[model samples]
Target: MLYLSQVLGLVTLALWLYCVFDVITTPDTLCRNLPKIGWVLIVLLFPLIGSIAWLVAGRPERTQAVTRPSAFPEYDRPGRFAATSPDDDEEFLRRCRERAEEQRRNAPGKPQDES
Candidate 1:
């Protein structure tokens, strides 16, 4: 009987400490039924009963995890632009080809016969 009482006392102490800590750590926005300070006071003062009440009435309800949509999912990628298709910028490609042909013609080492 004495041993059972000791175990129960330890359990109650653990529960009380846990509840107090929880109340203190819980965010003001998330706490229900009362403000964060109120919950902290209740848990601190009433131990087991307050802890039970906190669990039932003051604890934040579990919410579905929210997944935010990316503002620019395609363009947000690292080292990549929003425009993935080269076909969208045909003029840019045309200028690049013209520059490459002009450079080839101006090469100092190349024989004139190749032209």
Candidate 2:
């Protein structure tokens, strides 16, 4: 019985140590919003409750692969024109519209223009 208790204690200690090491060495990206050292103290000082806290609060969130740029990606990047809008210039858009119409006329299945 005493041997069994000793073995159980050793197992618990090993689990505690592993949790400590894992939390401490985990990178910020893998651990979400906590410092590794902070995890160490929590797991060390309060074992059961702290480990539970780490499980619930410190686990990493999975990020999805971003396949394309967002429709409004320009808002966050650093640039001189970050606050400006191309739509503010009407003349620039008039030329663009003319070019689009020209391309559409040249595309397949388009009827030829008649004077």
Candidate 3:
């Protein structure tokens, strides 16, 4: 009986410490029912009951896992923007290359090939 009581006491102390640390480290936004400080005080004052209360009522609810959409929409699908826009088209690239060649030829120090 004595050994059981001692074990119970140790368990209670461990729970109290865990609750205190959890309350301290948990973000203010995630804590529910009361403010972070209030939860801390509660855990400190009444170890077993307070820890249970924090676990049950004060802790944040777990968010649901994000699932993939059933119908894969065009815009939301993979590689939606892989198709080249007008600026990235082959004609646009040819025009840009021609302009660069013209500028290179017009530069004063560049010797033009007379072929």
lDDT of all predictions, in order shown?
Answer: 0.84, 0.73, 0.87
TM-score of each: 0.55, 0.41, 0.54
Between the candidate structures 1 and 3, which one is better when assessed by TM-score?
1
For model 2, residues 60-113, the per-residue Cα lDDT tens digits are 544633245669877657763643466987877899999998999899897888
On residues 12-109, what C-alpha lDDT tens digit does candidate 3 reach at each position? 99989998998998888888999999999999999999999999999777773334566847877776666678775988889989999999989999
Listing every candidate in turn, what is its Cα RMSD in Å to the true structure after a full C-alpha superposition?
6.9, 10.4, 7.7
Of the two candidates 2 and 3, the one with more favorable TM-score, higher being better, is 3
Clashing pairs in 1: none
Model 3: which ten-residue window has the lowest total lDDT? 64-73
Question: Which model scores highest in TM-score?
Answer: 1
Q: What TM-score does candidate 1 get on C-alpha atoms?
A: 0.55
Q: How high is the lDDT of residue 77 in model 2?
A: 77
lDDT, model 2: 0.73
lDDT of 1 at 7: 94
